[model samples]
Target: MVKVTFHQDPVTLVGNEVKVGDNAPDFNVLTNDLGIKSLADYQGKIKLISVVPSIDTGVCSIQTNRFNEEAKELENVSVITVSMDLPFAQKRWREVNNVEDLELLSDHRDADFGEKYGVLIKELRLLARSIFVIDSNDKVTYVEYVHEVSEHPDYDKALEEAEKAE
Candidate 1:
């Protein structure tokens, strides 16, 4: 039950708290086309998962776009952005922002990703901002649970770990 702040107010996070060295949890998130994609879908590739409350928000947009830009250079890494936004909204946002290198997934159907990753904001039905770096073997190498939901994550550190995992 890790706690995070949405706007300087405490919020509850539901589900298991993931940590480095833990086997990455598999979750069924909707792809842009409404197809299901789980952690196993990315087997054999290092994963940089960026979790945000919603894709339309300012911090989330910047965070996702930064990773999308970086994804072009991370050849062996599969960068993904997960949010509670609908699949339609996720696709629209990606197209509007020209974010092509990363996968934008929706956890709206079920809070699977949000719950399994310990990022679900109980009161708001949104996910807390976080970053996860998983190695090719599906073991978590780095994890960042951003204390403030509106702030940015430690991108450099997460990217470094993803590169090393590759």
Candidate 2:
């Protein structure tokens, strides 16, 4: 279990048992297209999974757009945005924002993805902000659990970590 805090208050999570250099955990998540996808779908590719509370908010949109612009240029790289938002909402956000590069996946249906990754916020119908980077071999290499729910992550550092994994 991982102990994280929001506004200085502690919350607990049963984090994925997988560790750095270990095989990445695979789970299915709903896509904006209303399709199920798994980690194996992007096998042998470098990936950055961005877990956010919601995309309708300003901060989420900014982070999504930032990574969408920066990440698309890299070859064999998959940048995914995960949220508790329904697939419909995800699609709308992507369409309205012209978010073509970053794939938005939803955990509203089953939320197994969040549960497996330990990002599910139990008290709230949201997912904790996190960044998980997996390497070409589908091994976890970098991870960050944003302790505060109201803040943005260190995108620069996360990108650097992804680059290192590449």
Candidate 3:
């Protein structure tokens, strides 16, 4: 488990992140359209898994935009933003915000994907803001634990590491 501080106190994640060299756990997630998707769905492509608490927050929005920006030049890479928001909300956010390239995935129905990935906050019922770069074979090549929930990650570094994952 990973210890995180949120709401001025500490919370624990269900499990630790898949290590840098470990294979990412396969999970079924709902897309903005409520369609089921899995890590396998992104096979043969570099995967940037932007795990967020919720897109309603400032930090989440920042991360989503950053990934979407970085996605422009990264060929064969899919930037997937995951949160606990409902698929309908995700779609609305995408439409309103013009988030065209980035895909918003929701974990509202079943949170097993979050737990399986070791990012689900037990008490808060949210995901810790994290970034995982996975290779075509679903191996975790890079990982980041954004300890400060309100802060954005080092996008330049994460994107640079993503190239290596390819």
Candidate 4:
């Protein structure tokens, strides 16, 4: 149970706490087209997973866009942004913000991503802000569970590890 603060208030996070060297947990999340996707779907590529409480929020939008911009230069890396927002909303946000490089996924249907990744906010039904880098073998190479849900993640370190990942 990794605890994080949302708006400076403590919130409970459900599920296993993922760590470096651990096998990345597979999760069922929804694509912008409402299609089911799992971690295995990104096999053979380094994965940079950006988890946000909601995509519509300022911090979340900025975080997603930053990764989207960085993804263009990350060869063989599948950059994904996960949120508890609806698939329709994720699509709309991507269209409005012109975020095309990074795939925006929805965990709203069952929160499988959130729960499996230990980012699910029990009180709010949202995901805590976090970043995970998984290598081509599906082994986690880096994990950042942002202490404050409103704050930004350490993008540089996460990206660096993703680049180093095989």
| Model 2, span 30-100: residue lDDT tens | 98888999999998889998988899987788888989998877667899999999999999989988998
Candidate 3 residue runs with Cα over 4 Å from true position:
none
Q: Model 4 RMSD to the real structure?
A: 0.7
Per-residue lDDT of model 3, residues 1-166, tens digit only: 4556776577788865678889888898898777899888888898988989989888888789878887888878888899999999889888877888878999888886788888888887898888899998888888887776666777887888888776
Best by lDDT: 4
**Please, what is the whole-model Cα lDDT of each candidate in the order they appear?**
0.94, 0.84, 0.84, 0.95
Off by over 4 Å in 1: none
Error of 2 at 71 (Å): 1.5
Give the TM-score of each candidate: 0.98, 0.92, 0.95, 0.98
On TM-score, the stronger of 2 and 3 is: 3
Q: RMSD of candidate 2 to the true fold?
A: 1.6
Query: Taking the tens digit of each residue's C-alpha lDDT, what string does model 4 give over 54-90?
Result: 9999999999999999999999999999999999999
**Candidate 4's error at 131, in angstroms?**
0.3
Model 2 scores a C-alpha lDDT of 0.84
What TM-score would you give candidate 1 relative to the actual structure? 0.98
**CA shift of 159, model 1, Å:** 0.8
Q: How many backbone clashes does candidate 2 have?
A: 0
